[model samples]
Target: MALDVQRNWDVCMAENLERVTKESDQPKDKKDARETTRAEKPKIWKSEPVYLPDEIIIQILEYVSRFHESQYTLASCCLLSRQWYSAAVPMLYASPYLYGKNFDPFQAVMIPSRNLHVRDSPLASLVKILDLRGLVHQASRRITARLLGRTKGNLEAFIAPQASFGTNSFAALAKCHQLRILDLSLVSESPPLFELLKTVSRLDNLTTFRLPRSSGFSTDVNPALITWPRRLENLALSGGIDAHFMHGIVALPSTLRSLTIEHCPSAKGFALMHMLRAAVRPLAHLETLKLANLPRLSGSACDNVLFILPGLTRLSISVDYITPALFDFDVSSHREAIECHYPTLPHAESLPTRHQWTDGKQCELRTLELTNSGNPGVEDKVSPIDIVIALDEGALPNLRQVRVDKTLLWQASATAADVDALADALKEAAVQRGEDESTSTGVWTF
Candidate 1:
């Protein structure tokens, strides 16, 4: 070892001497000055490692991967090196928007039976959002279950496909305690409602849930039979929900903040009114209520809404359900006026009083949306004149935006003269009150 070391040192010194002798052969004093300059000059090319720390490099690549169209950038990053690939691979698979052409490839990757040693698969744990909304004829129910089984521990939001989601899928889904949102509204052939509810209620972290769209029921919902998850906040029910469920006190947990009921053919005005007065009114924190495409809800259906939920801020219901009574500023003082002028119930006075009406309270409604544009209930629906008069009389004083269909617009109404007169009165009232005008006294749609 010593002899080899001495030989290598001798070779290096000999090369150094030959180079110095060549430099000295060109003028002695100049060579000495040149050698001193070379020794003092800083080396521009660095020989030490020039790279970021693993943690910082990972963070930078993860940030770059967040852009919607940066898949190409992420793909390039994965090819960079083993460290880069490890950091970038997780982001690439975390939230897969699997649809159309890519569904097959993804299914192959997630299926445990097809791949060996999936028990400790890091790819399965990395997936957080698995949305298969575009699926139709591409997959089967068992495949969905397999996918769920692999991702159960970490899956937070899962939008099940419109088809091929069945009982097998729920077996895996019920175990996903970390789930937050499950939207199965588009399912056509769904599992039995009772079993479905029972399965999902076990999800401890579920917050937002959407029921199947085809869910109008023949009988009322049994609140006692159901165990609602306490963390749930947003719920959407289908048009098939039974009238008995709407009329009777249905099981709406107090945790709910937003509710949507649409395409309910069996829900009559009286049933809906009963629902708001009984089931919904008790929810203190309720803020957004949407009722749309409900054909059976006829004639001033939501007239008594303010009396039910005074704290409601955003409302979307059918046009026929709304009336001048809803906007009566002196509604607190004129209970008789509502009974006499209601368009739907001319004999409201004669009907049995199912609800113990509350003292008429001011609504916190800021946005009012009117749906069912094609219903064409010109005479029965709340008119623009009613809105103008209501605004002028200081009803819904805090209202800011009103949305309705283009058909509801009075831009070319044959009876525009009446609405115009009412609009002018509302403008004058706004000016008198020193408030900003425009609570949808202009062009609007739902």
Candidate 2:
């Protein structure tokens, strides 16, 4: 090594000496011109390579991951160098948005071989969200199960495809202990309710769970056999859950904070009321409730919901199932019936009467959302004036927001004055509560 270095140094000196000798042999004008040209040339400064700690690099990558178009940037970063590849590969695979064209490629990478021991990619373990809701004909049940098996180690959220998910997928799903959100609402052919609930019972970290719209709990689900995740906070129930199943759910987990029931074809008004009184009223931590699209519900089915769930802070109900009497106190048969059912209930006496209800104190409801269930004449069932009158009578004193659908014709000139009154009432309520004036507290139509 030393000899080779000495030889190269001698060769460089000889070349420099030859160049100098030639330059000295040149005319003074030529040498001066060469020197001036060299002086006019630009100089480049080389900077030292910067080194960042791994934690700082990871934080920056996380921020980039928040952008919707960050996947391309992250993919490019993976080829920079070993250090950059190590940092970017995980973020790139953490949450992949699979569409039709890319589904095959993604599956090939995740399941390189049918034999598990022969091929397994570390990238599968980096995935925290495996959303296959976009693919329809591109994947099959077996492939979906294999993909889940590959990602179950770290997967936190799974949105099943609309048609391909089946009983085979549940085995891998049960192993995903880190799952937080499971949305199977789009499944056309849902797996049996018994197997789904059994698999979900082991997910200790699950928080949000939505049942498929095709869920048919025909006979397998026993009320006493049902068990939910320990920390479940939000739940949605839909489809084929008839009066029998509705009444069978005697208890929901106490940790529940939000509950949504929609698109039930067989749920009658009386059965839902029974469930609310017997099962839902005992949940002390519940806050938000949404009910919509029940074809079997009567026009006056949900009028007594406010009386039954007095502790709810947010309620979204279809105007088809309610009337102006929804906000008006029914100290008659409805009130007596609720009291008759739960004689020891604490909020039984506080079911406000038209003459005695205090402003904002009688009702804890803060937001009311009105939706249409495609029923004719629903546009006139509940109006802006009706809500304004409710506010005037101090029915919902804490109500700050009222959202209506455009199908309700709330923006028509006939109801313009009433809408104005509703807005002013909301603003006044916000001000009385010492809330910001710029807060979105008024009526909104969609």
Candidate 3:
């Protein structure tokens, strides 16, 4: 009986030993599985610190002066580093002018439906500027509505001609409260151009405005022409605009500093002179004035306008018909005109006389550019080169820098001897005036 009991105890001890070994192995297996998971974990790359500072990035962007060619590359720079992105995105989106082809992709995707609304979509926030050129087809109305719905409050500038902004486009644009600038230059077919302009009058932020050839709007409307933004400064007008329109424009915000009138044919020489007389009185803040490609501006009219706005620092006038005879200063017309119109103010003190034909006695005239008689006509008998020489020596006594367009120089029939004589005269004049004898004067010849 004692042997049988000892055998039973040995059997029980074996079973206990087996159970202990299984329990220990199970914990080891779990620990091994955990170790395998840790060893196989995936690695991720961390973002690197930006190498350049923000100011340096801005300076680099400023150095990239040619915007059109470099804009795409510069825009991509935004994705490269956060600093580069912040600096380039504003410039990239600042003056967004869209041509005709830019609307293709948008048009393809914007499947028109009576109930479609872009405002409900998540893609609405990406758009800031919309250029709807040659987009006035049947699909235009729907596309314009969608675009406006998406960007009504966000859009800052809209540059579309009259045709693109038919009734529907106009209605959509009317909702754009944040619009600051409008360029309506390419629309020649649409008659409701004035209506579009009238709609924009409600925009308190509308500042810079460009109008194409035709005063169809000005003729019909007599209201205050522009209720521009308080910050409105630059205005560019092309083709023929009426005198009344000019007056209304000048009456806009007094902050106007730059004004450009290009290819305005209806502005007769004398009529423009009178308009300048009336307009320059209030636009004393104007610093830069450019009148280019106007066919009717006579030399006398140009001179009269210049005398009226003597406070102008940068003046660009391209009147090919002007002659010295125009400067004959008829007592009845010019003397009283100059005295009455030219104001002697503190701003006039800094006016550079580099191109003004004045006796060098502490004169105030900064930069003067004049182009005359580049076209072949009976009127261009006097060589422009000789006139330039005479003006440099006599009229522009305080001359600092002069740029003569090559068109005038190429048309001049002066011989080599004449050219040499003119150069010598300029050298003598420079010496007498105690001015640096640098070739700051450029003669552009086409």
lDDT per model vs. reference:
0.73, 0.87, 0.59
Residue 61, model 1: lDDT of 73
The superposed Cα distance between candidate 1 and the true structure at residue 384, in angstroms, equals: 4.9
Q: Give candidate 1's error at residue 256 in angstroms.
A: 1.0
Where does the lowest 10-residue lDDT sum fall in candidate 2?
352-361
**Structural similarity to truth (TM-score) of each candidate:** 0.72, 0.83, 0.60
Candidates 1 and 3 compared by TM-score, better number: 1
Note the residue pairs that clash in candidate 1: 215-240, 216-240, 216-241, 217-240, 239-263, 239-264, 403-445, 404-445, 404-446, 405-446
Measured by TM-score, how close is model 3 to the native structure? 0.60
Which lDDT tens digits does candidate 2 get at residues 260-357? 99988988988898888888888989999999999999999998888777778999999999988888665664765456564675785566563442
lDDT of 1 by residue, 342-427 (tens): 44654546532323333345667767777663576544366667766666666666565566655665545674676566556655
Candidate 3 contains a number of clashing pairs equal to 12
Backbone clashes, each candidate: 10, 0, 12
Ranking by lDDT: 2, 1, 3
Per-residue lDDT of 244 in model 3: 58
- Of 1 and 3, the candidate ranking higher by lDDT: 1
Residue by residue across 1-446, what tens digits does model 3's lDDT show? 99999999999999999998887778787878988999999877588765887788888887773565665677688798777777887665544434465555554433334455532543344456766654555335456656676667678877764454445666767777788877777655443545755676677777777766553545766636545556667777676576656555446467788788776776766556655666654675787777776776664456565455555666666646455543232333455454444545234343434334222222223344555534455234334455456455464444344444555453355544554554555556677878766665423232
